[model samples]
Target: MMSCSNERQIITNAGFLAVVASQATAGFLSAIFSIIVLRKCGNLHVHQNCKILIVSMVMLYIVHSVSITILQTTQLIRYLTYYDPCVVGLSTVICFCLRLPASVCTTSFASLLFAIVFERATALWKRGKYDAYGPQLGYALVTISIIVSLASTFWAVQKVEFDQHSVYCSTATSQTADRVMLLCFLISGVNIITLVGIIALFIFNEFALSRREFDLQSSYQLRENAYVIRIMLPLSIFQAICYAIFSISSGLISLFRDKLSPVQHKTLYTTAY
Candidate 1:
């Protein structure tokens, strides 16, 4: 048997371990799915520009997932060794440099997911000439998404200055926690909207549009665009679920913050991150 403090320490360690495991699993799965999509996009029969948009979104998500896993793993190790598990031990410079990439990529991923659905909608609507002019629009959307995502996270980055005197470094800190929560909420809303809209579009096109007669070539193109949208539907739903989970977890952390022990708060915050 152990004392109460010892038992608490064990639980804390377990929580950190769980966060690490989940991050690792998420990174691995994202990598696998991204690779498969990259290989199969040529067969999707959508415009080449649409395919470019899809590939860009996947690349963003894969980098986001991998960077998040790496950051959280370091957080776990730092939490275990540091006196204050609620805060990180890395210097402000190192932490900012390490965390900035993941933060930027994650925001870009969410923004780009919305962009992908919007592009597909346009491509479907302008099926006749989309293949010719769509690439420029695709490139433009990608640029806009990166700019928007970076702007969204710029507020958080301002908090990432070097402070040697008793400075704490994780996103778990208040300086960043609010911004993170807001971003999660945005991601969750974006994903849910896209998921519902994608499903509705798919059903309408498959049943309503398919029932009508059209020229052979035009009908075939319509069906191919539908196929592209159909394949992306699952991905949209997956993103919705993942972001919803993160948002809910972050909400729970806020609701129970004052009531929770430092260990519990840290665990929840780190997990949500």
Candidate 2:
């Protein structure tokens, strides 16, 4: 059997490095992606609302990447140098440090995507007048998304009791701590719905295009909606996969945590990270 201290040593040296590398790579790619979107979409004259939604997503990705990198790298150095103990679940301090901000960015991005779907559907109800939609509507959707994200995030984590001074950490804390899984489940569910909603919107647009002819303006709007879906679907799929893994793994850990051995606990937490 491995000593507890030795197990910690192995994970700190091996795992944190991988975590840091992944965050750095994610950040770099997000920055490049943002630049490309700005350049290409500017040339294409995509509407202000579409630009706002796309830019908001890229910004969230960049922020999430930076925050995770710093949090992981700081914890990595601390564990490597004997300044912080490596716990099976993250140390309370590290979890507290990264939880809120990262979760907010994640929640906000998904919320914005949902808003896009809602806004497009509403625009269609406006029919020929959809062309008159203004940037204020875009701003309003973005504002609503941010507010809802903040509210949902607070609601999800309300039960997690953080002890800033405690080095001890485990899968089980307050009985209410299991509630954090709510956030994971909610985000995962929302992403899945976003995926389905966007696909349906695209299909509807294609069907409309194929069947009856429309005025030049309505046809252009329909085609534009479909084009936006093409660009956004890859992102929807990626987020869906990411959140599904997070929610499933976290749910499993919460449910079976009592049965897991120390090594199993550590392995699950590390992978979920």
Candidate 3:
């Protein structure tokens, strides 16, 4: 019969290998897509701000993918050498290190999407002026989001701990962590709201285009605008939904973590990270 320790070892190894394989494949594909988008859309003049925002978002995803890949690779290394799949460095340093990149990347990505929605709104309402300053506005929003995300994640990581003997790391149930989770929840909610707003705006634009009278040039421009919004809306909504669900689930799991069985807790923690 397999002892508990042996079972744990098997699980740890499987988890480590699974994370490594999945992260590597995802990172590779996302990197390729990022490169393609940057190359194809880099020089487009119209919707320049939107293009830049997309590239920035993709870059964040790439960074996140790389961070997770490095993390899992390290875990794989530890597993091969020490028969322990979890990282072996100082508890706080290694575990919280993962949180820093993951949180910053996720928060920044969501904020960028919000910025894109704002830009779209502005374009719809004030096409000429918004285009005049859209690129600058986009850049400013991205920069500010990066700064805030970094600060928040830095604060949040302080509450995370990695145990050498455990299969996964954990965030301490402290006031600080609670505050961080609240901030995350707020961001997720905002993302969802922004996505819905964007969808509404797109629908309004489509209705206006179909019903309102316009000259030839004006009609063409409105149609183009409507088409672009139609294409992007699905992708944006999908991202928002995914982010919202993940954030809500994580928050709930953390809140009720004490009630979870050991295996369930470990599974959730591993999957979350």
Best by lDDT: 1
The segments of candidate 2 whose C-alpha lies over 4 angstroms from its true place after superposition are: 1-41, 83-97, 165-176
lDDT value, residue 183 of candidate 1: 74
In the range 104-141, model 2's lDDT, one tens digit per residue, is 88888788888888777665545466777778878888
Estimate every model's Cα lDDT from 0 to 1.
0.69, 0.67, 0.64
Candidate 1 residue 264 C-alpha distance from true site, Å? 1.0
Off by over 4 Å in 1: 1-12, 25-29, 40-43, 76-88, 164-169
Please provide, for model 1 over 1-33, each residue's C-alpha lDDT reduced to its tens digit, 9 standing for 90 to 100: 124454346346676568666776777787778
Clashing pairs in 2: none
Taking all chains together, each candidate's TM-score versus the true structure is 0.80, 0.81, 0.78
lDDT of 3 at 252: 78
- The better-scoring model by TM-score among 1 and 3 is 1
lDDT of candidate 3 over 55-149, digit per residue (tens)? 78878877877776666666556555664323333255565666467668877877777777776676667653454454686787778878887
Better-scoring candidate (lDDT), 1 or 3: 1
Where does the lowest 10-residue lDDT sum fall in candidate 2?
164-173
